[model samples]
Target: MPLTARHPARGLLDATQDDLGCGWAWDQVHNVTPRADLSCTYCQHRMHAKRSVAGLRYFAHDPGGPQCSLGLETMEHRLLKLQLATAIRGAGHQADLEVRGPEGRWRADVLATTGSGRRMAWEAQMSSITADDARRRTATLAADCVVVCWVFVEGHRPWMPYVPAIRVRPPADRADPWRVITGLFRWTGLHWEPVQVLLDDFVAWTLNEQVVPRRFSPPRDYWVGGWTAPQYLAQAARRRL
Candidate 1:
C-alpha cells in the first residue's frame, strides 16, 4: 500500500489529504471510476484509493497487478511514512514520497527539502536489518551528500545509536502521537542525555536547524559506547550559530 499514486495527467495524487478530494475527488477515485488511471509511483502498477477501518487513506494496488516490492510494504511502514510526510509538510518543507536517486542508487521513503535547498531523506525502517547493512546504506546516502534519518517504529533498534536514527514508541491508537524513545539527545554541560520529544516537533526543529546530528566519537566521555556514533545534538549553541 502507498499513500501516493501517479496520475497520468495530474502527475501525483496524495491520498492522505483529509479533504473529500485532491485535484480529483475521493468519490471519483475510490471504487467509483476504476478507469481513473492512477498507478503506483514505485512500480507503475495500477492503484486504487483505500481507507482503513480507522479512516486512514492510502492507495492499494488494483487486483491482478504484478507483484511490486512496494506491495510488500506493511501497514506499519505505510503509516510511519505517512506520518513523516505529514510532519515534513507541516513544517513548510516539500515531502516527496517514494523519491529515488538517479539510476536507483538510493530511494527515500519521504524526501524532504528545505526552502534553502537542503535535502534529507526520512526512512521508516520497520523491518529488521543488520547494523552492517544499515551502515552501508547510510554511507551510500552520505557519499551523495544526502542526509538520511532512519526511523524505527517497531522491534529492537540495535542500529539506532550507530546511525543518525531514532526509535519511536508507536501510538496505541492510530490517532495518538508517536513518542521518541531514543536516538535524540541533548548535551548537558558535561555529557549527553536522552531528550523526550514528540515526533512532529523533532522533525520540525530538525528541519529548522534547532537540532543537529552529533557523533560521540571517543564516546567514552559520555559512557555511551563504541560503535555508538551519530546521534542528535538538540537545541542550544548550534541553533545560535
Candidate 2:
C-alpha cells in the first residue's frame, strides 16, 4: 500500500535529503547518537541513524542518552504505528495512516476514510495497553466509523475482538511432524504443541472448555511471559522519559 497525500503539515524543521519520502528528519538536537551531525532546536537530544523498514524511513533516537528523555521502547512503538499505517493503506483504503485529531492533540495510528466518506480508526497493539486508555480512545471513534484493535502476535496471526484467534501448526499427516512439533514447542513455551484447528474450533475451546488455560492474563504478570498488546500498552503508559 502507498501513503495517502493527506498528511497534515506542521511546524517541522525539514532536513535536506535526496530521498525525502524514504528518510526522516527530526530536530537534530534531540538525537542521541555520538556521531549525529544534526542538532535539534527544541531539545538537547541528538539524532541517531536513519532506519528503513517495509519501505518506510524513520530517524532513530536513543532517549536513554544523557540528555535524552523518551524511552527506546516508546520510539519503537511509534515506528510500529507507522508501519501499521502503511499496511492499512496498502489494503486499498484511503488511509490517513497517522494524523492529528481535530483538536490538534491526539494522533491516531491509522485513520481510514472510505469512498463513501465513512471514517474508521485502527490501533495496532504490538506493545502494552491500559484498559482505561483503550476504553477512552475506543469511545472517541467517530459515530459512523468503527474502531478496530488489531493485536499482532509476532509469529502468529493477529487477534481481533471479533475474529477468533488460532495458533499456527503443522499438518498432522506429515511424516516428520516431530520436527515441526518441536519448532512450535520452542516457539511458544507450552506443555503441548498446538494442533491444526479451525478458527471456530479454537474460539469454542477458548470460550467453552478450559482445555488450555487462558494463555494470557492481565497487567504486569502477563508482560513477563511474552509480548502481548494489552501488556505493551500498560507498560507504555507508565514510562517517565
Candidate 3:
C-alpha cells in the first residue's frame, strides 16, 4: 500500500475574535504559547501553532494524531470565501456564508440569492479535485436550481501553460447563451481580486489553438466594458514575446 501524508495546514472558519474560543483564533495563533483553552474545530484534538517563513500562522496536531478534512483548507480558501460573501451581499444580494442546502445535501462556501431570484453557489477551489467529483457536486446543486461556479485561486500566474480555463455554460433558463467565461483569483497584497471575462466573440480567437488568457483585467472596476476574445488573445500573445 502507498503511504499517505497528512495536510499541514487548513483554513479556519473565521480568524476573527468572534471565534476566540476555537483555539486557532487569528489573535491566539500569533501568540508564543500553545493554547490549552480550545480544541481543534474539526477533530477535538489540541492544536499548536505553526508559523511559516513569511510569518503566516496556522494550526497543526501533535504527532500520531488523526487527520481532519476541514483542517486541510488553505488560508486562501477561507479568505476568498469571506470576501466573496461580502462582495455578493454588497451587490445587493442576500448572501450567506457556509450555508447548507436543503436536507443538508450540499454546502456552499458562499450562497447568494439575487434580487431576481437567481441562487448562485460560489466555490473557491484551491485544492485538487477529480473531474468526476466536480461533475457530481455540480449535478447535485443543479437539481435544486442552484448555479454553482468554481473559482480558482491560483493568484495571477495565468501565463503558466497548465493554468485552468473554463467553458461558460449558460443557465438552463437562458436561450442559447454561447458565451465563454474564463478567469482566476489574483492576490493583490491584501486581498484576492477576481478577474473574469464573459465573451461572445470567442469563436474568432479560438481558431488560434495556441491562444489562452492568463488573467482577466476589465477596463474599469467591476465586470464592465466590452472585452472581446481577440483582445485577450492579443494580450496573451504579447506577453509571450
Candidate 4:
C-alpha cells in the first residue's frame, strides 16, 4: 500500500518508528520497543508486519482483508503525498492528508485551505495515471468548490493537456539543479521544494512560444528568455548579481 502510517500525526514523511510510514530505520523501531499499531490506513483493517527473508519489512493486511484500491500505492507515492502536505501546512495553511471528496467519489492526497480561505487539493502522482482519471478527479473536486493541483514526482513527467502541475524531484548526492532557471528545486539537501509557476506563463514559455521550445536550443536560450514567470524572476536575480 502507499506508504501509510498507523498514526499520521505529523506528516507521514517525517513519521518516526511509532508511525511506521516507509523505509524507516528498523533499528530505531527496535530500540523503542513499543507495541505495534498495525491498522491499514486505507481500509482500517487489521494488518501485520511482513519481514522477508531478504530483510525487507513492510505492512500487509491479513487474509480476507478489504480490497482497498489505494493499497497499490508505492512507497515513493506515499512519501511525495506526505511531503507536499507538510509543505502546505508549514506555509500557514491548514492541510489534511488523504481527504475524501464530496460524496466519497474521489479522494485527495493533500487537501489544504490557504490563509485566504481558498481550498485546494494537491495530488502527488508518482505512479501511472490515465488522462481520463486525472480529469475525472479534477472535475469531482471542482464540483465540490475546490481547486485541483497535480504534483508530478521525479521519473513521472506530465503529459499533454496539462492541468496545473508542479514537478518535484527526489534528492541526489550531486549538486542541486534548478529547472530551466526556475526556482523550482529538483531537490536541495534532503527536502523537495516545488516552486509555484503560473500556468499561463508556463504554457507560453513551454508550448506556445517558439522562442523557448521543447529543448534548450542555441547558446544560452534559457538565460535570455524572460517570457515565463521563472525566467523573469531569474533575470531579476541576475541583475542583482
User: Which candidate number has the best TM-score?
Assistant: 1
Let me know the TM-score candidate 2 reaches against the reference structure. 0.39
Each model's C-alpha lDDT?
0.76, 0.36, 0.48, 0.51
Over the stretch 1-241, how does candidate 4's per-residue lDDT look in tens digits? 5334454432242231333435555444332546355566568776555544534444556678778766666666765665565556545566666776656777887777876676777676666777666767766787888866566654544341434455555445224321322223222334334444533333223322222212123553222112224444444445546
Candidate 1: stretches off by over 4 Å: 18-22, 218-241
Runs in model 2 with CA error above 4 Å?
1-49, 52-56, 61-83, 143-146, 154-241
Report the lDDT of model 3 for residue 71.
Answer: 63
Q: Which ten residues in a row have the lowest lDDT in candidate 4?
A: 207-216
Question: In candidate 3, what are the lDDT values of residues 107-198, reduced to their tens digit?
Answer: 78667787678787766666666655666777688799986656554343232222233334342443443233444333444443454433
Q: After superposition, which runs of candidate 4 have C-alpha atoms over 4 Å from their true positions?
A: 2-38, 48-64, 155-160, 173-241
Clashes (backbone N, CA, C under 3 Å), per candidate, total 0, 22, 1, 0
Please report how far candidate 1 places residue 234 from its true position, in Å. Answer: 11
Model 2 / residue 194 / CA error / Å: 14
Worst 10 residues of 1 by lDDT: 221-230
Candidate 4 residue pairs that clash:
none
> In lDDT terms, which candidate is top?
1
